[model samples]
Target chain A: MVNRCLITPARTLLTQTINPSLRNGFPAMTEARVLVLDADPLPRLDRLGARARVLHTDEKSLAERLPEADVLLVWDFTSDAVREAWPGPGGRPVWVHTASAGVDRLLFPELLESDAVLTNARGVFDQPIAEYVAGLVLAMAKDFRGSWELQRQHRWQHRETFKVHGSRAVVVGSGPIGRRIGLLLGAMGVRVDLVGRRERTGDPDFGRVHATGALPDLLPEASWVVCAAPLTPETHGMFDARAFALMRPEAHFINIGRGQHVVEDDVVEALQERRIAGAALDVFAQEPLQDSSRLWDAPNLMISPHMSGDTFGWRDDLAEQFLDNFDRWYAGEPLFNVVDKKLGYVPDH
Target chain B: MVNRCLITPARTLLTQTINPSLRNGFPAMTEARVLVLDADPLPRLDRLGARARVLHTDEKSLAERLPEADVLLVWDFTSDAVREAWPGPGGRPVWVHTASAGVDRLLFPELLESDAVLTNARGVFDQPIAEYVAGLVLAMAKDFRGSWELQRQHRWQHRETFKVHGSRAVVVGSGPIGRRIGLLLGAMGVRVDLVGRRERTGDPDFGRVHATGALPDLLPEASWVVCAAPLTPETHGMFDARAFALMRPEAHFINIGRGQHVVEDDVVEALQERRIAGAALDVFAQEPLQDSSRLWDAPNLMISPHMSGDTFGWRDDLAEQFLDNFDRWYAGEPLFNVVDKKLGYVPDH
Candidate 1:
């Protein structure tokens, strides 16, 4: 059954009235009132003013206005309002979408139990993350960091570096991001072992797609080990002392996955002891890692502040995806990218 | 008919009398007296004892010893012995293989006219060069350089980066090295445009292949422009002022090819003007690039001492390749990776 709900059109009316001066060829959205909970105001909403009412609010004001909205667009991922206000009086907004993957911050007991639809920005990050992983693999293999340091000192020391082709790699995660990483490395004649929840036949040239249980055997043979897995009960702290111990002393470890999946202290120890060659870490268990953290002093380590998938024009892509999803919903078609309450994706697992 | 040559039993007797240690497994001209003219000794050849006598000589000794050797293995790439002495020899060796790629130093008129076969260490570098190109592409796109700087300053700034997938790239050169680079990037979902010497049918991924003439059109559209072309009359200084101007302002240029292909001053001007985003250079017109060079101060530039295709087991692989070629030669079978004298490869073309 399709959920139909009425929305108060004040915000939509205000947005429509303000749009013409801002954008050229602005499109009108005339179906429902859309409440945007974003830290910064979106100027593109002016284009959708005629068909839809757009209201802007922060976390504090969201709960009071929850009942009147027909849809909730979570643009401010840092806010927890979506979780707190989702179980409001008029049976929650018919649909809710976050402009980010991993809806951990927006999940609440009440929202999880509701019939409201949830979707995420999944496809947008696949390529960027894959590219990041490839870069790290190359950087470590070529010793770009060492070369850069040498250049600064005006040193002309020529040293040999490792090669990516004909090397073995293990990409841990079967989602879009991990699959893309595997595909990129595989194209380069690298033997890639992809680890997923379960083996699937449709995957591309993956040497062996094993379950998480096979990681112990796979780690020792890999020349480059990458963690692109999600942060879940089974995945958290998965790359601990034991995993690092299993890897070849010359192997490089990279993490585009959540920080908790790797124990930071264990990684520090491994790098200090040269158990593993080096690592490129984008995410951390804590955001804005404290300046005093010992990871800064670890040899051969690269730290990026959790920005692997972000790219120019990303927001525009997210908005376009949602608009396309909205059109599909209005036409009585099954919504694409529906998040299953249990699996946190569409078609309910 | 294929050229046929034979080694007499007397010559083999001379090798056995001078050096018996080379009889076991020394691959390169085991039954020949060899001369190494480099300042540093070839430690790699230490195992090739009695059957192959290695004489470390200066210009004077090299001039005196030129008449007796069965082969000349040029480990000192900077020396001009082959160019000066080949014509003066009583019985010059039948073969000469340089440890370096460019034959300009040894390609004297006398050697060119002689029956002496010449080869370069070509296969050993193909994968490593490809890997280096991949690293530069990833590093530029991910802003890895900027992130490293931020880390040094103890700042955690999250910035956006571009994805490699669905992005367009142009790899100039169709040799084993360039082809491998294309394959690696293609695996990452990038639509790679490969520019070769000339366009042909029945080639791998024929649809994406382009000729050198297409550079003007291809440059602007390429998000990442990789220069892997060999140094030739046409390729020398190919990526100069006009080439830099044609690129998209956001595009990144990487040179794994000869440094002569790029005009250093023009590159500096382009970088200074921000007409092109950045570049990573592993080669230069003058290596051990002058310490006073202005390129050091150029914004968004990465420099390395031309060690892209070098790795730890590289010499071992070269030895293995030579042995395989030796087996083919001894068995009167067609040799693999034969260099065409005119095209600098065995007439596979």
Candidate 2:
């Protein structure tokens, strides 16, 4: 018999064994090994371990043991140890999966050049982001903060607020997050204009979707402008003083994308001048925004610690997604959500 | 020619006439008796005097001339004078339309009993209320106020947030405003449970609706419970201490309905106790909430000065609704949005 290997069907093994060569002619009783990196509780890996030989290690041990593994599941979202440590002396794992949507944290030149497949947690964040955008739009329109203040004082003041219907909105970025945001708003009767990288067909009820170049025209008409695009060279610092100036004096802005996409100083300036009505920001240019930043005092602005796409049970959704992908991989079927190293997505585009 | 009256339309009519009937019908007529509520510079109405009788009234003269008018278009919402002073002793005007919703300020028993027909601005407010609800949801979910404080201090903390999807919401009222709220949230993937007065078929999305009695069971499951119901004997103070106590600690309460529906002291107590997570109130038991009231200081509370449904150009939509009704009445067509006097709405039920 050919030295055939039958990888114990762990979630990770199932994901890696999708290659026809790996599945059909293997040493029949030999188990494939998987390395799970940087998981604290390691329940998901433990569950996989029941079916296969799973080795779990933190950053301290990963570099030493990575070469023996057939698959690697990168669970540590905060560290790029996988990129720096992967592609060992002989040959690397056939596949790698990240527990996050953005793999910029894990991208390495070597990983990009290698034939190893890459996948990410994609669909998990879409609805949450869309919901977050809706919430921001409502908070600004209804003056929720003001209401909370009144409740503290037992004061009831009747003030006029703006309505969403007949209002125009511009959702920047055409990714799943942005598209979902548009769908939610469009259903509310607000005329939504979705600005994507380029136009595509069969999109539902979008009032108008233009390229980034059309933002100048779209901005002036928008009562609410949402930023849900990714953080890329093209999107970094895309919202600045000029962008704010283009918006209506009554318009409100919301950012659920990467923080670096906005020029923080310009946002503060525009708000201080009362040029735009208000804004809700979930991401900042810097993490753990320094305590000394002046954005806190910017008038009409609502800030949230970046929590828009992070929700309860989110981890479970990511785990489930990985398991489904693993099943597809083991069956030699085309994998879903495979990331294109260059565009950084499976590129539904 | 039936009295042979000639009514000449004013040149400024294009700007002031929001009612389609007035725009299309009055302008084409060369001879019809017209009474313009001429106040101030009155040039717009003065031009009409050339071919028809124009009644110039200050605050004092309106009561005396009201009976002779064939129709009364209440453009001024500030005047409660019409409710108090209109002479219904003789045959009242054939029609009365207010350029506002909630005819509470204008409705009198005499007007109800007279041959005069009444219509109010209803549909104008539906979308605005819906938008307001969306804002409240977002503000609470995203911790917008907290974020704002952090932003003011230039502190960025990336925290996890509760998502609107897979969450349950209950909209207490089944009117256009409440239905619109349900629809908006539903679009965001929230499982919306609309509670109306009673169970009925053919209602929009009635599958999700429950009766008022089901509120106790629904409260515990709802992440958001919105109050858009009208104020009635049964509904007054419905959200009492017990109701608040029933809500989950993670739930948020929003009141866009009349303030009298909520027990202010009880709501404060609930928030203080953390029995329910938070609340956003736009309407209050008293208007211009007293500065000394303790509600302003309530923990996890959001207060808006009752401005949710009010928006720019909202008055125009209200005006158009009335004008459409006027045309229907003159043309012997059944009127739309006729008030149910007892129920305070046209009996869509």
Candidate 3:
């Protein structure tokens, strides 16, 4: 079945011929096996017709086929099957690409410590998530969600709403997503202070993203605190009770990053105790947020099913990003958006 | 009680003393009655104490005291008392200003034709409305409203949403509010074309605002179309069946303008027939949107009271704007935001 999916088109050959120096002693460019762990229809790779062999594996069969592929594409980004499947592998795929911004689920010890290279679909989600964050900030301030509820109830409630202009925001994560959020908010007249690894210089959008040490000080002044950081050991549960406690009672928190960055219980407690005004959490510690979670019952909290950046045509963007990298892999060129295995994220320059 | 409110301090004198050449034959500024049509707490004009006589009148007493005041401040902008009281046989205030952007309710023919100069709180509402329009655009594109509803229901349903970046938007009204909306949307990678009275030049915000005539051609191309125009005979009911027909089925309509700009029946029918995707209406022909209105039952319709521009400190802003103008008028200086009486709205330069 997998053999039938191979197609060797002229474009693949053209790429190999153009970069003969990269061909070296590498495996045949047109015969590389491409395994995709897919939950939905993957973007068509007919352009690589017979040049790259493709295979789709579900969670059940994912482990059995691990060693048979030259490259693996984690199309089902929300699944943990790759991590579960990697341990029993005879040999890992030389390259693994996840159709997601974060590689938390795919960052198991075996994969991180292995010789395999990791890349993620980064740029595709940057503006979409930024736009979503901007939307949440406006919606909450205008009490638009309340307006929607009133509309549903056929009530005309006129109330004074908050202002976005001149308001202060501390956006955690100085990556593309956070920077975009800061820029968008800043354009709307919000005073934005983006928190990253260290104080960044020469950044046109955000003047100087403050260092991590400043988060504690920044949190106290933020009316809108946003978390857009990548998940890693050092950053895991970074927004714990101490972070939540530092924020003003009127402040709102939003998490569009990996759910692991926040302590769910601390947030829930904050919401219950009215430590924070509200939150619009698109990511949670566990998604498809289980019915048993106390978050649903918490006051003034907005829960979304982890799709902040999952805009339409996103799958196609991810597929095209992977295809571009695949061509580079065939030519043995350096891949784009390569994650720092030691840092477990794309390290900022 | 009204006599006690007057206080004409020397800051009033500073202007009069400095602009002596301009204060020719004007009525005694110290004894001038400043009648404030107040609904909520009026702005403390204590600075003008004893110099300018002040009277606070509710809707019931407004007509009785209309002839006594030299200047009228329409602080209760929502009331129709000004229109109803204007036709009474009494002397009129020489200068009248409404603490609202649009003065539809106050634009009676007698007042329009009268020599009384009319002004509005134009700049105060501009950015607030622009911010609201941007919020609506992003909310609709990301289906953030649907997510809010799901959050309320405790449902974890993930859905495909649209991208805001690279999307097209046509913002009606090239005034401060519309230009601001165009600028904000453009900042987020949305291609924004602003429509105004005539193609405006030297507009730093919107490079060039398309003439209102171009709206017919521009409507079909927009993914999100925003209306922030003033209500006037030329603009009334412009978004009728023909306009709705011109829009794509996927396009979303948002009206932050006076409700009269849209024909309620046409939009409802369009939404009902699935001719248009959805609408987020903050204004209606009759607001506190009547329960009997079919718009309430219209699918995918988002309704909000006419509070789009009414932010937290908006009242203070409106009051301060009026007070600034009052000082100018006392000095016999040409009042700012003076409406072109013939046009029924502020005419663009």
Task: Highest TM-score: give the candidate number.
Answer: 3
What is candidate 2's lDDT per residue for B1-349, written digit by digit as tens?
A: 0011111222223212223355445443422233223322222333232333434454576777776565666665445667766785553455566655555555567776665555666677777888888777876786777766555556666666787777899899887788888988887778898998776556656575678999988888999999988666668899999888888999999998888889999999999989999998877787767787777778887777767777866655655565555444444356666666666554453
Docking class of 2: medium
lDDT of each: 0.73, 0.71, 0.81
Better of 2 and 3 by DockQ: 3
Worst 10 residues of 1 chain B by lDDT: B1-10
Model 1 CAPRI rating: medium
Ranking by TM-score: 3, 1, 2
The complex in candidate 3 yields a DockQ of 0.70
**In candidate 2 chain A, what residue range of length 10 has the lowest lDDT sum?**
A1-10
lDDT of 1: 0.73
Kindly list the per-residue Cα lDDT of model 1 for residues B191-285, writing each as its tens digit.
Answer: 88899877755675536568899999999999889988767667889988899999999998999888888999999999999999998888888
**Per-prediction CA RMSD (Å):** 6.5, 7.1, 6.0
Cα lDDT tens digits for candidate 3, B170-194:
9888767777788888987899989
Between the candidate structures 1 and 2, which one is better when assessed by TM-score?
1
Sorting all predicted structures by DockQ, with the top scorer first, yields 3, 1, 2
Write the number of the candidate with greater lDDT, choosing between 1 and 3: 3
